[model samples]
Target: MSLLVVGSVAYDGIETPFGKVDKILGGSATYISLTSSYFQKNVNLVGVVGKDFSQDDIDLFKSKDIDLQGLQMDESGNTFFWKGKYHYDLNNRDTLDTQLNVFEHFNPKIPESYRDAKFIALGNIEPSLQAKVLEQVNSPDLVVMDTMNFWIEGTLDALKQTLKNVDLLVINDSEARELADEPNLIKSADLIRKMGPDFLIIKKGEHGALLFTDDEIFSAPAYPIVDIFDPTGAGDSFMGGLLGWLSYTNDLSPQNFRRAVIFGSVMASFCVEEFGPDRLRDLTEKEIYDRYREFRELSEIPEVG
Candidate 1:
């Protein structure tokens, strides 16, 4: 099964308690596609970049064997850049700067070769643009979309329209609450699911993640990561690992969805250990498998009778 990811691929300047990086490859699509490539072989990426986009970063994509046919290079301006400073707690961050640059005028153009993808992951972008991408692709087996508070607040109508077309929606707990206008997370999931997607995932940062459907409500514990460096792309990485596993197995059962959630948590735990996505680059299959087992053991109860 082929996977298509449409979103930003830009540079980020991150400052965290552990350290700082002036510039690193960080974007919704960058982290989503890179971490997904570990499980999904046919990963296709689509986004725009400025001439300032370096060859090293291009090589990084190539190293993972990600298909880049849909990537566009605009010589007119610089790539989108965002700088944020994380609080000492590593759970909150404040944006220092944001330069939309070429991304300001982004209009996704899906290549002909990518039209037949089986899985589609729409990263954080304008809801209208996300809908445009959906219109171009073939009947994808599963469609997962990610959104943020910015779009929820500014483009509520459009976001709700787009949500109707996706199969799953992934957003953090805060975004979930805001989107549903509810204080309780479990209630938020039900409200948001009524907007469109049949499934919803509410990420709780270090606390864990919740999977919600009309028939099932699963809770997966987060991998206990020590020495967290940067939390920048952990959510995206979680989505990637999830869709990556689902695409690899081509399974959509409730039981399998639970496993995918754990795999997602495993990838995310590794993501925060380093700035950007550097840690995901060196992960071995054994490491991922071992971590998945550990997550499974987290909530398992020993027989008492």
Candidate 2:
């Protein structure tokens, strides 16, 4: 099975209590593709970069065995650049600067080879663009889309239109509450399910993640980490891990979905251990599975038999 990811690939300048980096390999698609590459062999990436995006960065994706046929390069423009600083607690962050540049014109064109991708992941981008991706792909088995509050508020019509085609909707708790206009998550999930997707994943950051369907709800706790250096790209990494495992197994059962969320948390926990995708770049299957085991043990509440 193959997976296709459509999102931004750009440069990021990050600052945290640990240290600061002027520019590094970063973007929703970059993190998602890197994390997903660990679980699946064929990961087709679709995004745009500019002349300023270095060849070394392009090589980075190739090194991960990520297919870049759909990756576009705009020689005349600069790559999207974002500068952000994280709070000491690592829960909240402030965006210092954002330059959309080439990404502003990113119109994803799925390569002919990727048109039949079994699984498609639409990273946090405009809902119209996410809908456009679905228009190009041939009957994907699973369609997962991630969004933020920006689109939920500014483009509700387009967001809801895109939702109709998505199999799973992944968004954080705040976005969920705002989207459904309900304070209660369970109620919010119910309202969201009516909008489109059969499944909804409400990410609660370090608190954990929740998965809800029409008939069932599954909760996955976040892996505990004493030191979280940077929280950037954690959510995308989570999505990558979740979709990567599911794409590898080609299983959509609720039980399997529950496991996928745990694996996602596992990957996300590792993401915050270092800045950008440095930690995930060199991760091995053994390490991922070992963490998965820890997650299982942590959540396992044995019955008093």
Candidate 3:
């Protein structure tokens, strides 16, 4: 089973209490493909970059067995760029600047070969653009989407339309509440389910993630880490790892979903340990599973009153 990812491929400058990095290779699809590559070899990436994005970055994606045939490069413009600074707590950040450049006019064209992909992960992008990718894919078994408050607030109608076409919707806790207009998370999740997706995943940053379906709810806690340099791309990394494991195991059952959440949390913990996408870009499967084992051990506790 192949995984198809659609999102931005950009340059980012980030500042954190730990340090600062300027113009690093950072983007949602980039992180997702790189992290997911550890589990699934055939990852089809669909996004656009610009002339300034560098061939080295493309090569990096190729090294991970990511198929970049669908990744377009606009020779006329520069790739999207974003600058942000993180607070001391590492939980909140402020966007300093954003330059959409080529991404401002991004029109993803899904290749014919990529149409055979069984799993499709639509990273945070315009709802209309995500809809266009879905229309192009031939037969996708599972369609998961990630979105932010920006779309929910600015493009509610489009987001609602896009949600109806997806099987799973992934968003952070704040986005969930903003989208549902409910302060309570559980009720917010319920409202979102009514909007569209059968499965809703509310990512709670360091607290962990919560998965909700009509019949059940499962929660996974984030791994305790000593140091976190930057939290960028952590959510995308988690999504990548979760989807990668699911694709590799060829299991979409509830049991598999539960396990995938743990795998995702493990992957995310590694992502925040370094600046930008450094840690996940070179992650090994052994390392991932080792952390998974550690998480399992830590999570298992004898009956305690």
Per-residue CA lDDT of model 2 for 1-305, tens digit only, reads: 99999998978999999999999989999988999998888999999999888888888889999999999988979999999999998888899999999999899999999999999999999999999999999989999999999999899999999999999999999999999999999999999999989999999987899999768989888888889998989999999999999999999999999989988898899998998888987898899999999999988999997
Model 2 poorest 10 in a row by lDDT: 213-222
| Model 2 TM-score, 2 decimals | 0.98
Q: Is candidate 1 or candidate 3 better by TM-score?
A: 1
**Comparing candidate 2 with candidate 3, which one achieves the higher lDDT?**
2
Order of models, best TM-score first: 2, 1, 3
Error of 3 at 116 (Å): 2.0
For each candidate, what is the lDDT? 0.93, 0.93, 0.90
TM-score computed on alpha carbons, candidate 3: 0.97
Tell me the lDDT of candidate 3.
Answer: 0.90
Score every model by TM-score.
0.98, 0.98, 0.97
Per-residue lDDT value at 211 in model 3: 93
Error of 1 at 214 (Å): 2.9
Which pairs of residues clash in candidate 3, taking residues 3 or more apart in a chain or in different chains? none
- Candidate 1 least-lDDT 10 residues: 220-229
